[model samples]
Each structure stands twice: as C-alpha cells, then as structure tokens.
Target: MAKTIFITGASRGFGKLWAEALLQRGDKVVATARDLSTLDDLVNKYGDNILPLQLDVNDRAADFAAISKAKEHFGSIDVLINNAGYGLFGSIEETTEQEAREQMETNFFGLLWLSQAVLPVMREQGQGHIIQLSSVLGLVTLPVLGIYNASKFAVEGLSETLAAEVKGFGINVSLIEPNGFATDWAGASAAQTTAMPEYDAVRAAFQAGLTDDIFGVPEATTDAVLKLIDSENPPLRLFLGKYAQPWVKQTYEGRAAEWDSWSEIANAAHGK
Candidate 1:
C-alpha cells in the first residue's frame, strides 16, 4: 500500500534520495528542509504528491505546525524519518560548552520533541513508524569526533527505550545506522574545525580520511531503507551498508564482553 511519509532534511543527501525513492514507490511524501526553495526538482517532478515545506526540527512550534500542515495535506503520516542532523567533529576538550549544547539540541532534543508531537497522532490512529538517522559512530566511538559520537549514542539509547514504549501503542521505532556514505553530511554539513593547533596532526589525518573513495552509494542505503520500511518484521535497528555491519557487530560484541566481565561488580553494586 502506498503510504504518507514525512522526511526531514530533504533538501539533499540521503533524505533527498529517500524522498525520490518513496515517491517512485507510489507513496506520498512530505519533504521538508530549513529552506523549501532548495527542493525545486522535487516540486517540479511531483507537484501534488510531494509537498515541500520549510522545517527546522530544532524549532518545536514550527515542527508541530509543519506536522499539522502535512497531516492536513496528506491525511496522516505513516512514516516519519528524523534525518535532520549534522556532524560536529572535535575533541571533548576542544568543543565549547555552547557547541556541545547545540549538538544535543539538534540531534537529541529536537528529535525528542518531533517524536512527541507525532506520538499522539499515531497513537490515536493506532499505527505509525518512526525512523531515526543514526550513525555507525552511534555504536562505536572514535578519536576527534567525541561530541558527534555522544549525540548519536544518546539517540541510540533513547530510540531503544522508545521502541519498547511504543510497541503497545501500535507504533514502530527503528534506527537507521549508516557508515560512510557519498553524502555531504561529512563534507558540507561538518562542524567548524577548532582546537586545531592542539591536535593538528590528528585533525589533518581525520580530514584526509574523509574521502568519497571509501563511501558507499546513497541509493544502496535508500534501497535497503525501502525494503526495511516495507518489511512486516522490520528490525529495531537496521545497518545500511557492508562497511557498517562489521563495525556494528564488533561494537556490540566488545561492549557485551566488557559488560559481562564487570557483571559481578555491577550486581554487587546493586546489592544483588
């Protein structure tokens, strides 16, 4: 069945590809960005079926209004993709307090509010899907991108809890974990490079590492997403590319072993 889908950060990158893909599958898409003018091709291609709107997920009021408007336009939202996020690449000591807060506000708090706004509607209707665009870093932390890791780690935690909470409400929550994609996420959307002199070598190495040669095709991930979205038994977490699978597996295994090793102390601390 063709459903109504709302995707944030639809102006470019994965969100843009997803919108086009969904529309090709005969679904109605409410594609939004901070600036709707950037969605010219979509508007020209699928005028009525694809509704373009201006949305800044960080703004609670505006987001609510946009959802309401989309509901009025498309009847109801069957799938909500929280894809509006950026990479803040810097060490913990280097990233300012303001930058950290902004990072959480956009990646964590903004997602929370949007999910909250959509919950009531989905609950009343008795079915909905919430998709989060998490990173491979959500499962594994690396040097120099501590703040970005923190934000995604927070999402992973919250999304896990939300999956359990909304199951009874007939709502589904899934996290999309993608590795290095040929998207502007690391290129155009990257945070300002600060604390340069302190970690010049590491910073330079990191910059040199982000190349399109290693990135996977965006369509492959989007195609996997389409399958995931349509599957009757969709996983709570979906790893997009082959590059991410090994990392996700290793992270889970390593973390599990570490936790198990500390289980005795953990239980003792809890007075078990």
Candidate 2:
C-alpha cells in the first residue's frame, strides 16, 4: 500500500533524501521548499508522484494553505514530515533578538503550525503519522549551539505532548532525533551570529566537539526513515545515526545522578 505524505524543507538535506525514498517506494509526496525551482529535479524524476510547493513555513497562513492543498490533492494525508528547519550557531550572549526569533520561527513555530493544520485531516482519516526532525542536541546541550539547542528542546516537548493528545485519533507523532549528518544543516542551510570576543574560548570548545567522525553521510539515513514511516508502531522518538545514542545515554545518566545527588535537598526544601 502507498502512503500520501507531506514534507517540509524538501529542497535538500534530510528532506530531499526522505522524499526520494518515499517516492521510489510508490508513495505520493507533497514536498515543499522556499524556492519551488529547487525541487525541479524531484518533480521531473518523480512526475505526478511528487507535488512541489513553494513554502517559507514561517508564514503560518501559507503553511496552513499548503497543508490544506496537500490534503485536497492526496485525498488524505497519511504522514506529515516536519523537516523544515535550520541550525543557528551562537552562544546565548552572542545571539541577537532577531536571530533567536528567526530560529524559533522556523524550527519551532513552523512545525507547530503545520502540525496543527494537518491534525484535522488526520482526525478525519482516523490515522496519520507526524514525524518531526529534531536533533540529538534536543536531548543534550553543546556550548555554542545554545539557541539551536533550545529550539529543538521546544520541538521535543511539543511533539511529546502532541502524541499524547492525538493518540485517541490514531495519529502517531514521532521525533526523529538525528545526530550530526553531512547535510547542509550546519553548512549552507545554517545561520550564524556575529561572534563576540568573550565567547571565543566557548566557540573553540564547540568546534572541538564537532570532529569529522561525528557526522554520518546524509543519504545513509534514508533507509531508517523509510522503515520508520512504514512501521506499524513507530517510536515516539526515533534516533538516527549510531552517534546519538551513546551521547544521549551519557546525558540521561548524568541527569539521573545529579537529581539523585539533590534528592536530600529537594526533599528538605519541600516545606509542606
């Protein structure tokens, strides 16, 4: 059976990779990019199997309209992949108001609005899947990726709550937490803040963490994504790449230890 899927940020990176995989497997994809021309190759190759739309995603009205159009074109949306987001590189002090807003607008609010738009359609259909493109950064933190980290943390919370709310409607929500991949995510697709001198050492530490070995080949993720989409019971959070788990494991372990360490004080502070 073929699925009717809608995906954002389909011009390149994980979005383009996943779109091609779905189309090749006979799924109908409503793919969106800021510039429709960016999707020309997919349109030409996939024919009517792909619907290319021009979407900035930050425009709530446009996103809702795009979702509605996709619903109409495909009859029912079986899956919605919210992959339209970029990385913002800056420490908390180095980041400006505009940059922070832009980060949240694209990564958090855009995904929120799109998810809301598709929910009604999924409700009508009685089943659907919403896969969000989060990052391993959502679960942990890095020095200079502060704003980017916050945006994904927002996404993780949002998707988790959405899953609980929509489970009764048979709509599944999943967060795809990818580790660093050789995608434009941190390259051409990324935005950077004007570096402040105070954070130079912090930036150096961040740079040191981003070794060549941490990034997986972007195309290598397609198979896992396809498997997730096809799953009868997909996970609420699916981690892509082997690099994500160990770090997340360490993060959780450290968190548990700190919480346990504070248990006495935590209990003592409870005046009640």
Candidate 3:
C-alpha cells in the first residue's frame, strides 16, 4: 500500500536516501530539513509526491507546526521517520556544556517533541509507524563519541518505552541502530569540539580502526529501512549493517556479565 511518510533531516544522508527510496516506491513523502532549498532535486524529480519544507527540529514550535502541516497536507502521516540529528564528536570532558545541551536538544528532545505532536493524529487513525534513527553507539560506548552516545542512549530508552505505551493504539515504534555508514555523518554532518593534545593518540588509533570504509554502504541501509517499514510485525529495535549484530552482542554480553557478578549484592539491597 502506498503510504504518506514524513521524514526529518531529509536533505542528505540516510534521511535523504530513505525519502528518495520511498518516493520511488510510490509513497508520498513530506521531506524536511533546516534549509528547504537543498531539497530542490527531490521536488523536481518526484514532483507533487514530495513536499519539501524548511524545519529546524530544535525549535519545538516548528516541530509541531511541521507535523500539523504534514498531516493537513497528506491527510494522515502513516510513517514518521525521526532522523534529524547530528553526531557530536568529542570526549565527554572535551565537549562543552552548551555542546552537550545542543546535542540532546536535537537528538533527543526534538524526537520527543515531534513524536508527541504526531501521537494524537496516529491515535485517532489507529495505525502508524514511528522509526527512530539511532546508532550502534546507542547500545555501546565509543571513546570520542561520548556525548553523541549519551544522546542516542536516551533515544533508545525513550523509543523503547514509547513502543510499549503506544502499541495498544496500533502505533508501532522502532529504532534503527546502524554501525558506521557511508553518510556525511562523520564529515559534513558531524560537529567536533576543540581537539585536546592528550587524546590525540587515542583519536588517531580509533580513526585508523574505522570499519566505515568496508561496511558503510547507504543502499544497504535503505534496504533495511524499507524492510522494517514493510514488516507486518516490526521489531522494536532493528540493527542494520553486518557489524551492528556482533558489536551489539558483545556489548550485551559484557553488560550481562557485570550484572550477573553483582546480582547477589543487588538482590540483597532489596531487603530479601
């Protein structure tokens, strides 16, 4: 069935790819970015099927207004893709308080506000899908991406709880956790703080070990996203890319080991 899909950060990266792919498949797309001019090609190619709008997800009023406009234009948004976020590349100490707040505002709070705005419409329609673009960093920590990791971790928690709370209303929520992908994510879309000399070696080593070169194809990501959207019983969390599986597995194993080792003490504290 052709559906109306609303996407954020649709100018480039995964969001752009998703919007294009959906449009190619006959879906109606309301693609938004901070600058609507960047979406000219989409409007030219897809014509009326694509609605390009200017939106700053950091602005709560704009978030609500965009959702309302999309609903009004397309009748009801069948799928909402919360992909309007950027990566903050810096260690926890190196990242400033303002930077951290901005990261949270865009990556976490923006998603929350947009979802809140669409919930009422979806509830009334009794069916909708909300896909959140999270990262493997949301499941595990990385050395230089501490602030970005924290923001995505918050998104994972929020999306999980929201999935449970809205399932009764026929609204499905899913988080897409992708490992390093060939997106502008690390290049143009990423923000870095002032480099510290002390962490130079660590940063160099991390960069040298990057798997992005081998496993960061955007087409594969688009395919995974389309599969999630088409699934009748979509998973609460869908990990994309080959590396995501093993990386998340190792993270969960480590967490389970730590919890098991402390289970006795943890249980005792409960007055048992």
- Expressed as tens digits, the lDDT of each residue in 1-272 for candidate 1 is 99999999899999999999998879999998988888998889888999999888899998888889989888899989999899888777888888998888899888888898888889988999999999888988778889889999999999999999999988999999888888888778889647868788887888787675668888777778898789776799988777788877887998999999999899899864
Instruction: Note each model's CA RMSD in angstroms.
Output: 1.8, 0.9, 1.1
The best-first sequence of candidates by TM-score reads 2, 3, 1
Off by over 4 Å in 2: none
Residue 252 of candidate 2: its Cα lDDT?
97
| Candidate 2 lDDT tens digits, 63-165 | 8999999988879899999999998888889889999999999999999999999999999989999999999999998888899999999999999999999
Residue pairs with clashing backbones, model 3:
none
The TM-score obtained by model 2 is 0.98
Candidates 1 and 3 compared: the better one by TM-score is 3
- Tell me the spans in candidate 3 whose CA falls farther than 4 Å from its real position: 211-214
Residues 1-272 of candidate 3 have per-residue lDDT tens digits of: 99999999999999999999999999999999988888999999999999888999989998899999998998989999999999998777788989999999999999999999999999999999999999999999889999899999999999999999999999999999998888888899999989888889879987888854545788877787888998889999998888888988988999999999999999999994
- Report the poorest 10 consecutive residues by lDDT, candidate 2: 202-211
Worst 10 residues of 1 by lDDT: 205-214
Ranking 2 against 3 by TM-score, winner: 2
Model 1 segments more than 4 A misplaced: 205-213, 260-264, 270-272
Using lDDT, rank the candidates from best to worst.
2, 3, 1
